[model samples]
Every structure is written in structure tokens, then in C-alpha cells.
Target: MLTETRRVARIVLLDPDDRVLLLNGFEPRNPATTWWFTPGGGLEGEESREEAALRELAEETGITDVALGPVLWTRVCSFPFDGRRWDQDEWYFLARTTQTATDQRGLTELERRSVAGLRWWTSAELSATRETVYPTRLAELVRTLLDEGPPHVPLVLAPEIV
Candidate 1:
């Protein structure tokens, strides 16, 4: 399969209670297998990663009144979805919002097909879930972020294949 390289911006969106919001989704080819991930997507046009982060948050989760924060991590990954091979460079940023309700009004048709829905999860929940999560050890990373705050520099995470 031909691989498409994409630059993606992801957010670790948290609520006042320190719970992180995750998107539940599965590859179109394999709906029986689903995974949870943060809210974000590929950059469009000339928009920077920051702009993409904010836009994706609203589009994917419908929470716009957010305080977008620093880039917490960066990762490179290869995954197959929607019948295409993708090589993605992802940046994970920190963001906060009080509104937990999500509106799918902004999701693209493709998104609607592949993305199941959004749910806010506490660190403990993240830790307990047997489902797959991207960026690996997400619960541990989130725990570190919450306990010690964002790193002085964005950490480069090991590549992932999904």
C-alpha cells in the first residue's frame, strides 16, 4: 500500500477534575477492534500545529472554549485506517475545558465513519482499561503529566504502529 505522510496535532484535553478526554474509534476495516486516543487530526493548509490542535479539538469533540497549553509530547507512527497506509508525525499538546458534552456537528464524513465517540477518563480509568491506547503507556504518561506537570521540553515518544 502507498503510504501518506501526515502532520497531526493531538491534545491531552483535561477537565477541572483532571480527567482526560479520549476518542474511541476503530479502523473501518475492523470495527470489532476499537481503541481510545486523544482529540486531534492532521494539519490543513498553512496552519501551524497549534492551530490544528485547537481546530481538531472543536471538530472532533465540540468543546471550543478551551485553554490550549504546551506541547507535551511528539511521536511518529505508522498505521492503516480507512483502507490507507499512513505515516504520521504527531504532536501532543495540553488543553483544558470545562464543557464535557460533545457535539459531532463538526466531524467530517470520514471521521463520522471511523470515530465512534468521545469520553472523558480519569487516570485510574485509563490505567484499568484493557483496550488499546496510542502513544503506549498513556495512563503512565498522563499520570506523570498530572503529577509533575508538562516536561520542560516536549518528550520524544517511541514510534507506534496501529
Candidate 2:
């Protein structure tokens, strides 16, 4: 089968303490190589990036009251998951909230099997930890955005490993 390129919208959910929430999951075929990523999934037909981001944030984390901010960054990533090669173009949005509780009832079957858990990470923790995170320079990007606010234009990020 031909590998299709998927368009995804993700959210960087920040708390009052400046920590960002991330979901931990692994490639189903290779569970040992786990990674953490922001909450998101592929966009549905005709849905705008922001709409997808909002839906995904609610579905993935069950936090729906936060105001979505502008696109902070974008990246193109290719990875293997569920026995398929996925080429995904992802847009990242910034959102802030004080809510800490999350409900995982909306997670898909794949997510339920592959996702290990979630955590809130400070910039320092993101920088110091060896665990893999997508967009590679998440700590630097988060610190910059927290310090200066969102940019006038969304920043382009480098591709990350599979």
C-alpha cells in the first residue's frame, strides 16, 4: 500500500505553572521505543486546523474549556506505527488552562493499546530528560513562547526521527 500523508493538528496545553502536558505512547510493533507527544490526531475531512486541534485536545485530554491560541509551530514527521508507515504534517497550537484532571474515555483503540500515560513537564525537565519527544527542541520552543508569547507567524520546525 502507498503511504499517505496525513494532516494533523496538535495542542501544547500549558498550565499556570508553565508546564506542558504530553502523552506517552509507543509504536505498536516496537513497544520498547516509546516517546511523548502533544495531544493531537489527524484532521477529519474539511475540518480546519484549529477545529481539529480543539476536538483533539478535548478527546485526548478531556480538557475543553481552555482558549486555543495561535499556531506556534509546524513540522513534518514520518514514523512507523500500527504496521504502517505514516507521513504526517502537524500544526501545533498553544493553549493555557489550570485544569489538571484528564479523562481518557475518548481515546481510540490504537491509543488505548499504545499509550502508556501522560505527564506535565517543565522546560527544565524536558531539557534534562533523555526520553524522546517530537519536534526535537520542545523545551527551547516552549521557553521562548512562554517568555515572548506566540509569534506573529507560526514557526517551522525540523523533522524528527521515526
Maximum-lDDT candidate: 1
74-159: candidate 2 lDDT, tens digit per residue = 99998778887889999999999989888888888889889888999998999898988877788889889888999999998988
Which tens-of-lDDT digit does each residue in 13-91 have in candidate 1?
9999999999989888789988899999999999999999999999988899999899999999998788877899999
TM-score of each: 0.96, 0.94
List candidate 1 segments past 4 Å from native: 1-4
Model 2 regions lying over 4 Å from their true place: none
Pairs with backbone N, CA or C atoms under 3 Å apart (clashes), candidate 2 = none
Candidate 1 at 147: error in angstroms? 0.5
